[model samples]
Target: MRDPAMIETVAVIGLGTIGTGWVARFAAAGLAVRAFDPDAAQREALPEAIRQVLRDGGHGEAAEALRLSLHDTLEEAVSGADFIQENVPERQAIKADVLGRLDRAAPVDVIISTSTSGLMLGQFQEALSAPERTVVGHPFHPVYLMPLVEVVPGPRTAPEAADAAARFYERVGHVAVTLQKEAPGHLVNRLQAALWREAVACVEDGIASVEQVDKAVVNCLGPRWSVVGPHMAFHLGGGKGGLRHFVEQLGPGIQKRWNEFRTPDLAAMTDTLVRGVEEEAGGRDLNTLQRERDRKLSALLAHLAG
Candidate 1:
């Protein structure tokens, strides 16, 4: 684990959508941020976005006082950082090459984290010299709003490193959960894939429109998930029976349904078809849609807190 006292500077490599958000999150949590992006244009936008998000999230004065340093090269960015979060594109070969380079440049004490959604941390760390210090710190989109982060340790990772990583995320207001063992998709991806398969099947089978499918869960299940996860929700739902009672009564039905479930044929579904439905629901205006979703998520979070 990182020495709680020694942890201070944070470096974000490849300041794309997720990287920029990471900078905002760490900076908002009161850490000095060093950000790098090859595209100078995108790097230039970081300060303004960070400002707006902090202001919108009710930290206006702190946002104005936020200090963020932008660097041109990845090596320059991670030079003296205590932790380096890599957010490059998700191709294994590309990740291997970039991570190998970063490993050479960063200090031995710096912890390197990959933001790979489902890539195995052990596999990625193989390209690095001190693979034991590298870990997967995967965050969902809009990292600012979603506090849930999956901390996956490689096969060679030290418990101290994992412990330190978890503590850092929690210090920054994230609900960091360490996977007992690393696996593809970690936890959230598996849960999302299960729902995605069902949704795609429903759409392909003509059982519901895409809009209807999205709305069904977003309007109902989404709110619940924003607070408690599935297990706790079911525990409360079991009424007198609780979890054990639920398993005895509904477990068989679930197994039967699982056996009958079919995976969706992605090749059969065209982007045109998907976008056609999306357009019908005003999909062309992405900002409006994302804003609407964020508004709903914020409201739900506020209500849950109350």
Candidate 2:
């Protein structure tokens, strides 16, 4: 594995939301970025998009110092790259094809990382000539701002390669959680999907409106989770006895609630969910809402850092 300081050049493929964020982050960390996308418009707009993301994440000087180059082809982008961050479409076939090309073109030791949110790393590794160099580095949306990244190594991945990827992410100020085993949705996304299922069920059952459900999380669980995870929160809820006492006293009720939780029929509830979200948006455009969310995220991160 190369030293983190030696990883000065990175390739960012697919200049969509995640790819753009990766370009900004790598450039902000003082690595030269070679970014590529099939869409000419996206390629043209890449610099400004990255600039906005860096500025929004409170890295205005990094934005100013960002060293980036746009490329027309994957081979061109990764020719001299020390690491490759692939953000192609989520489909297995597409990812596999792109990763295969990267494996054939990139330096033999260059770690190829995927930003796949749900797909298992094994699905893409099969097509790579150097599968041992591939790993999953799944990150949350607005990757430039989010600190959490799930690092999952494929069955064929080298331990050193995974370690190098994690070290690189940490060097760029992200919290890289190395998973012990591969699973669908990795770790954080699985947790998020669980909460989302319940939130959607509440709306589907008419027990709460979309806005109400969001408010519940923002006002309570969100702030608490920002400080401590669920298990610790429950441990605190146990008072003198901690988790054991809480479980003994509240186990049955919790079990009953879990049993009662329904799997929402998404097809049937689509109209309701759409209408509810429209109401919640209250005519705010996506760009406006995204900017506001990023601003607040920056503030929260600053507070947490302090």
Q: Model 2: what TM-score?
A: 0.96
Best candidate according to TM-score: 2
**RMSD, every candidate, angstroms:** 1.9, 1.3
Looking at model 1, the pairs that clash are 1-160, 1-161
Candidate lDDT values, in order: 0.83, 0.89
Highest-scoring model, lDDT? 2
Model 1, position 192, has a per-residue lDDT of 89
How do the residues 1-306 of candidate 2 rate in per-residue lDDT, one tens digit apiece?
667658999999998889988888787787899988999999999898888777866679988998999998999999888999999999878888888899999877899999998888887676778899898999888888899988999898999888999999999889999998789989887888889999889887789999999989999999999999999999999999999999999989999999998788878888988898789899998888987888898899889999
* TM-score, per-candidate, Cα-based: 0.93, 0.96
